[model samples]
Every structure is written in C-alpha cells, then in structure tokens.
Target: MSSFSADTPHSSSVMGRIFIYGILLIVAGYFLLPLLVMVFTSVKSMEEIRTGSLISIPTSITFDAWSKAWSSACTGVECSGLSGYFWNSVWLVTPTVSISTFLGALNGYVLTKWNFKGADVFFSMLLIGCFIPFQVILLPMARTLGFLGLAGTTTGLIMVHIIYGLAFTTLFFRNFYVSIPNELVRAAQIDGAGFFMIFWKIMLPLSIPIIVVSVIWQFTQIWNDFLFGVVFSAGESQPITVALNNLVNTSTGVKEYNVDMAAAIIAALPTLFVYVVAGKYFVRGLTAGAVKG
Candidate 1:
C-alpha cells in the first residue's frame, strides 16, 4: 500500500505539470497565430495569397513585397514608402524617451528624498494626468502646440509625447525611489552631498532597473501611437503609423495584400524588437517596488 501511494503521487505530479504546460502552449499559439499568418503572407506572392488559405505557407517565397513596401509602396499620393516615416519615428522616439526618462528620474528623486510641504498634494494631482484620456486633451493640446509654433511637426509630436508621458514615468520612478532606504540619502547629506550630487552619485547609479522599465514603456507608447501621429503631425513629418494607414487605404488598381502585410510588419518591428530584448528587465523593474510602494 505504501509503494502504491508513492507511485500515485508521482503520477499525479506528472499529470499536473503536463496540464500546466498544455495550457501555456495553447495560449502562446493563440496569440502567435496572427503574427505567423502575417509573416507567411508577407513573403508570398499575390497569386498564392489569393489561391491559398490565410494560414498556408508560401509555395514560392520572394522578398519583392518587402522591397516595395520599404521604398516604393504608395502611401496616399506619394510613393516614397516608409523609409522617411521610419526615420521620423526614430528621431521622435529618441529625444522623447531620453528627456522623459531623465525628467522622471529627477522628479522621482525630489519627490521621495526631498520631502516638502504640499508635495503629497502635488503628487496626487500629477497622478490624475495618468488617467486622463487622450481625447480629452486633444483640443487643448492642439491650441497649446499652435501657440508654441510647433503645430503639425515632428518637434510638435515630440513635445506632446514627452509632456503626456511624464506622469507615468514619474510615477514609475517615484515608486522605485520610495522603496530605497531613506537612510542612504541622510548619510549622503551628512557627507556634504548636495541634491544633484546625491542624485548623480547615488540614485542614477542604482536606478538601472527602473530606467529600463521607463525606456521600454515610453518607447512602446511613442512608437505605436497612431492618434497623436495622425492628429499632431502631417505631410513629410508624419510617423510610420500614419503612413501605414495611408498605404493600406490608398486606392490602387490592384490590392497588394502582400505589400500591406509587409508594411504592417515593418511598422510593428521596432516595438517587437524592444520587447524581445528588454522584456525581462521590464518585468524586474515593475516588481522592484511591489512590496514597498
């Protein structure tokens, strides 16, 4: 009976593991199915795409669709392709991510380490921005950008992303900073460290995890943003998302399904690459302060 009981528990454990792994694989396949279809379709010719099923592999693979999508695909009346718009996103994301992350780190350092009167009230107000809908700020932000002479420009889009993204970044850093022991700041002050000195020497050096989190968040938000790209920027200054929209909807003699799939993949590649590279760090940063703040 003892031997039988031992074998039964071992069998149960194996069954449990199998059940969990089965569920995980199913979920992964469900989410990845669309991406696989896109990749398969992007390499297939129009003839195969129309003749074969949506999930069918290409009988003959070719990169002509990718080539055209990158350089010659018509987006509205222009056929300049996504190369320019891609670079526009690169420029916009670079400055916006850098400036927002730094400002968030600075704000977080001040809010947590340098306690002052009305600081909690200020923080409470700042959190409100996180919940505000993008549509609510559209008209006001447009007016503000117009007054600043940045309307419908890449610089204008940069400004909008930085300002709007501040709340979340600051919130991330503040939570992280709060988890840090206050005694560290006090000890620095005892050694004659000033605000900027302590921040540069201590906070930033230890802020790697949260910094990764902030960068990924801001990068994804700014890169994938369509509404802001459409509404705030125009013409040559438009981002890749807007360009992709125009490419798909632009009336042509033949609907280039393969080219459309290729363009969509191109537009999504940056964010996907960022996540693949830094996703683990992102998870670590998010949990760095979970217990404390």
Candidate 2:
C-alpha cells in the first residue's frame, strides 16, 4: 500500500508537468507560426505564393526576393532598396542607444546613491515621462525639432529617440540599483573613492547584466521605432522601417509580397539577433531586478 501511494503521487506529478508543458508548447507555436509563414513566403517565388496556401512551404527556395529587397526594390521614385535606410537606422540607433543607456545609468546612480531632499519628487516627475503617451507630445516635439533646426535629419531623429528612450532606461537602471546595498557605496566613499571612482570600479562592473538588458532593450526599441522614425525623419534620413512602409504601400506597381516579406525579415533581423545573442543575460537581469527589490 505504501509503495502504491508513492507511485500514484509520482504519476500525478508527471501528468501535471506534461499538461503544463503541452499548454506552453501550444502558446509558443501560436506565436511562432506567423514568423514561420513569413520566412516561408519570403523564400518563395510569386507564382508559388499564389498557388500555395499562406502557410505552405516553398516548392523551391530562392534568394532573389531577398536580394532585390536589400538592393533593388523601389521605394517612391527611388529603387535604391533598403540598404541606405538600413544604414541610416544603424547610424541613428548606435549613438541614441549609447547616449541613453549611459545617461540612464548616471541618473539611476545619482538617484539611488547620491540622493538628496526632493529626490523622490524629482524621480516621480521623471517617471511621469514614461507614462505620457507619445501622441500627446508629437506636435510639441515636432515644433521643438524645427526650432532646433533638426527636423527631417538623422541628428534630429537620434535626439528624439534618446529623449523618449531615457525614461525607460532610467527606470530600469534605477529599479535595479535600488536593490543594491547602500553599504557598498558608503564603504567605497570611506575608502577615499570619489563618485566617478566608485561608479566606474564598483557599480558599473556589478551592473553587467542590467547593462546588457538596458542596451538590448534600448537597441530593440530604437531600432524598431516606426512612428518616431517616420515623423522625425525624411528623404535620405529615413530609417528602414519607413522605407519598408513605402516599399509595401507604393501605388505605382503590383505589390511583390515576397519582396515585402523579405524586407520585413531583414528589418527584423537585427533586433532578433540582439535578443538571441543576449537572451540569457536579459532573463538574468529581469530575474535579478525582480527578486532583489
């Protein structure tokens, strides 16, 4: 009877685990199916796409669509493809991410370690920036951009991204830093270390996981930003997202679904690659940030 009771609980646990796993697998499939279909469609010729179901695999895979999407597809009167816009994004994202992440780290360190009277109020004000809808600020921002003579320029776009991105990055780093022991900062101060010294030596080093998380988050956010890219930039300064939009919505030609899919995949690849490479770090940062506080 004792052995049978033990075996019954073991069987029940196994069944429970199997049930949970089955649900998770189903959810994963639901999300991944669209990506799979996009890839399948990207590699197929137009003739094959018309004949096959949307989700069906290509009869023969071809790179022609991808090649054209990257190098020869039309956007407006320009057929220069996604390359120019892609590089424009790269230029815009790199500086914006770096500046925002660094500023966020600095803001967080100051708020947490060097805090003074009214710091909470100030921080609260900063946090409000995160909740304010982008739409509410669009006209004001556009006016500001024009006033600064940055409208429709890459520099202007970078500035816009950095400003919006700062709130989230600061929130991330501040929350993460709040969970860190104050004693460490105090000890460093007692040891004759200055603000910059302590930050560079201790806080920054200990912040690797969060830094990775911040960078990846900022990178993805800035890279994939369509609304800001479109609104803040134009002509040669427009990013790939805007270019992809023009490619898809061009009124002058028969839409090439395959090329559109390929362009989307190309546009999506950088963010996806960043996440895949640093996914472990991203998970660890979230876990640490959650549990520490």
Candidate 3:
C-alpha cells in the first residue's frame, strides 16, 4: 500500500507533463498548418494545384511561380511583373520612414521636456487627429494634393505618409520621452546645451528603442498602404500596392488566381522580413519605453 502511494504521485506528474506537451504540440501544429500549406502550394505545378488536395505534398516542385512573379507575369500590356514596383516601394517608404521618424522624435522631445502655454491644446489637437479616420479626409487631401501639383508623384506619397505618420509617431515618442526624467534635459541646459544639442546628442541616443518601434510601425503601415498609394500616386510613380491591385484585377480575362496569390505573397515579403528582423526591438521598445516607467 505504501509502495502504491509513492508510485501514484510519480504517475500523476508524468501524466501532467504529457498533457501539457500534447496541448503545446497541438497548438503549434495549428499555427504551422497554414504556413505549411502555402509553402507546399507555392512549389506545386498549376495542374497539381488545381487537381490536388491542399494537404497533399507536391508531386513535383518548381520555382516557376516565383520566377513569373518576379519578372514575367503581365499586368495589362506591361510584362514587367513586380520588379519595378518593388523598387518604387523601396524609394517611397525609405524617405517616408526617415523623415517621419525624425519629425516624430522632434515633436516628442518638444512636447515632453519643453512645456509652454497652449502646448496642451496643440497636443490635444494632434491626438484628436489620430482618431480621425483616413477615409474622412481623403477627398480634401486629394483635392489639396491636386491643387499643389503634387498628385501623381512619389513626393506626394511621401508627404501623405509623413502627415498621417506624424500623429502616431509623435504620440509614441511623446509618451516615451515623458517617461524619461526631465533632469537630463535640465542638466544639458545648465551646460549651455541648446534645444538641438540636447535633442541630437543626449535624448536621441537613449531613445533608440522608441525609434525602432516607430520605424517598424511606420514602415509596415506605409509599406502596406494600398489606399494612399492608389489615390496619391498614378502612372509610373505608383508603388507596388498599385501594381499589385492592377495585377490582381485585369479587365478582360479569367483571373489568374495562382499568379495573384503569388504576387500578393511577394508583395508582403519585405514588410514580413522587416517585422521578423526587428520584431524583438519592436516589442522591447514598446514595453520598455512606453509602459515601464
């Protein structure tokens, strides 16, 4: 009887471990299933894809779709697949991210360390702008851009992202700089450090985490931005989003689902890569800079 009692606890521990491991494996499989399917589908021949079950392994694997998506798939009379748009997106997003991040850091510093009359009012107005839906201002922005002769240019798209990005970036950095002690600023000031000096030299270095967060957020948002790209950019200036939409929506033919899916996946690759690479900093920055203090 005593021997049985000793064995009973050991049995329960083993059972508990088994249950936990089983649940974890099931959850892992559930998450991995869709990714597995996409990879399998990507390599499968079109005939196989059309005929086979989604779970079935590819009878023969090929990189035809990838090659087509990169260079040959047609959008209208244009045979250049997604290569041009890929470079276009890189051009637009780089400037937008850099300029917006710089301005946001500036706004954050001023709002946090250097309070003056009407600062609250100004901050409130900016915060209010954040909640305003993009759709609401679309017409006005379009007209305004058209009037400025800025419509249909990469510059226009960059400016638009900057405007929209400012609100969130400012909010991010302001809250972040707020958590930072003002004594640092005062110390810099006592040493004859002016606004730019303190901002450039002191606060900027410590704010790397917040900057990473801001960059990642703005990069993803601006990179994936379909509506703005569609509206603000036209002709060759249009980003990959526009090309992607064109690719997926041809007027006079049977929709190529395989090409469309492949294009979509290719378009998503850069943003996905950005997140995968910087995801740790994204989380760490937000947690440390925003919430910890």
Candidate 4:
C-alpha cells in the first residue's frame, strides 16, 4: 500500500507534466504554423503557389522571389527593390534606438538617484506621453515638422520616433532603476562622484540588462513602425515598412504572393534576429525591473 501510494503520486505528477507540455506544444504549433506556411509560400514558384495549397511543400524550391524582392521589386516609380528602404530603416532605427536608450537611461538615473523636488510629478507627466494616442499627435507632429522644415524627410521621421519613443524608454529605465539600491548612489556621492561621473562609472554598467531590454524594445517598435514611416517619409526616405506596403499594393502586374512573403520575411528578419539573440536578457530585465527597492 505504501509503494502504491508513492507510485500513484509520481504517476499523477507525470500526467500533469505531460498535460502542460501538450498544451504548450499546441500553442507553439498554432503560432508557428503560419510561419511555416509563409516560408513554404515564399519558396514556391508563383504557379505552384496558385495551384497548390498554401501549406503544401514545394516540389522544387526557388530563391528567385527572394532575390527579386530584395533587388528588383517595384515600389511606385522605384523598381530597384527594398534595398534602399531597408538601408533607410537601418539609418533611422540605429540613431533613434541609440538616442532613445541613452536618454531613457539618463532620465531614469536622475529620477531615481538624484530625486530632486517634484521628481515624481515630472515622471508622472512624462509617463502621460506614453498613453497619448498617436492619432492625436499626428496632425500636430506634421505641422511641427513643417514648421521645423523637416517635413517628409528621414530627419523628420527620426524626430517623430524619438519623441514618441521617449516615454516608453524613460518608463522602462525609471522602473528598472527604481529597483536598484540607493546605497550605491549614496556611496558614489560620498566618494565625490558627480552626476555624470556616478552615472558613467556606476549606473551605466549595472544597467546592461535593462539597456538590452530598452534597445530591443525601441528597435522593434521603431523598425516595425508603419504609420509614422508612411506619413512622415516620402520618396527615397521612406522606410522598409512603407516600401513593403507600396510593393504589395502596386497594381501593375499580377499579385506575387511569393515576392510579398519574401519581402515580409526579409523585413521581419532584423527584429527576429535581435529578439533571438537578446530575448533572455529582455525577460530577465522585465523581471528585475519589476522588483521594488
């Protein structure tokens, strides 16, 4: 009876684990199935795509669609492909991410370590920026861009992203820094470290996880931004997302699903790569940042 009781609990635990794993597998498949179908479609020839099922494996795979999507696909008058817009996104995202992350870190350090008068009120006001609807600011932003002579320019797009992105980045860094021990900052101050000195020497190094989180968050948001890209940029300054839209919507020829899928895959690769590489730090940062000091 003792042995049976012990065996019964073990069996129940095993069954519970199996049930959880089964549910996880089902959820994973639900998300991955679309990706699998997209990959299959991207590799298949247009004829095969049209005749065969979306989930069907291609009898013969071709990379022509990928090549075309990267090098020769049309977007409006430009038939040279997404290469330019891809680079445009790179240009826009690189600076925006760097600036936003740095500012967020700085803001966080000040808000937490410095703790001047009305700091919470200031932080609260800044947090409000995050909740403001993008639509509400679009017209004002456009006019502001025009006033600043940055309308329809890459610079304009960069400014727009930076402005909107600051709130979230600031919030992230603030929350993360709040969890850090104040003793560290106090000790640094006692040792004669000024604001920038303490920040450069102490805070910045410890902020790696949150910085990674902030960078990935900002990069993903800025890279995937379509509304701002389409509205703020024009001509050669348009980002990849806008270009992809134009490529997909161009009415000159039969809709090429393969090319569209390839372009989408290409467009999506950078963010995916970033996440895959830094996802661990991202999750760790979230957990660590959630802790209150």
TM-score of every candidate = 0.91, 0.89, 0.86, 0.90
The Cα RMSD in angstroms, rounded to one decimal, for candidate 2 relative to the true structure is 3.4
- Top candidate on TM-score is 1
Query: Which stretches of model 4 miss by more than 4 angstroms?
Result: 1-23, 283-293
**lDDT value, candidate 1, whole model:** 0.90
Ranking by lDDT: 1, 4, 2, 3
Model 2, TM vs. native? 0.89
How would you encode candidate 4's per-residue C-alpha lDDT over 128-190 as one tens digit per residue? 787677888899889999999999999999999998888778888888888899999999889
Across 1-293, the per-residue lDDT of candidate 3 in tens digits comes to 23355734543566777998899999999998976776777677778888998889888888787778778877666878888888999999999999989999999899989998898889889887776778898899899999999988898888999998898788888888998999999998999999999999999999988898889888888888998998888877878888988887867465555566678888989887977898886676445434532
Sort all candidates by TM-score, best to worst: 1, 4, 2, 3
Q: Which stretches of candidate 1 lie over 4 Å from their true place?
A: 1-22, 284-293
Tens digit of per-residue lDDT, candidate 1, span 208-278: 98898889888888899999999999899999999999999999769999999999999999988987898
Best prediction by lDDT: 1
lDDT of 3 at 290: 41
* Candidate 3 minimal-lDDT segment of 10 residues: 284-293
Candidate 4: worst 10 consecutive residues by lDDT? 284-293
Of candidates 3 and 2, the better by TM-score = 2
Each model's C-alpha lDDT? 0.90, 0.88, 0.83, 0.88
Error of 1 at 145 (Å): 1.7
- Over all chains combined, what TM-score does candidate 3 have? 0.86
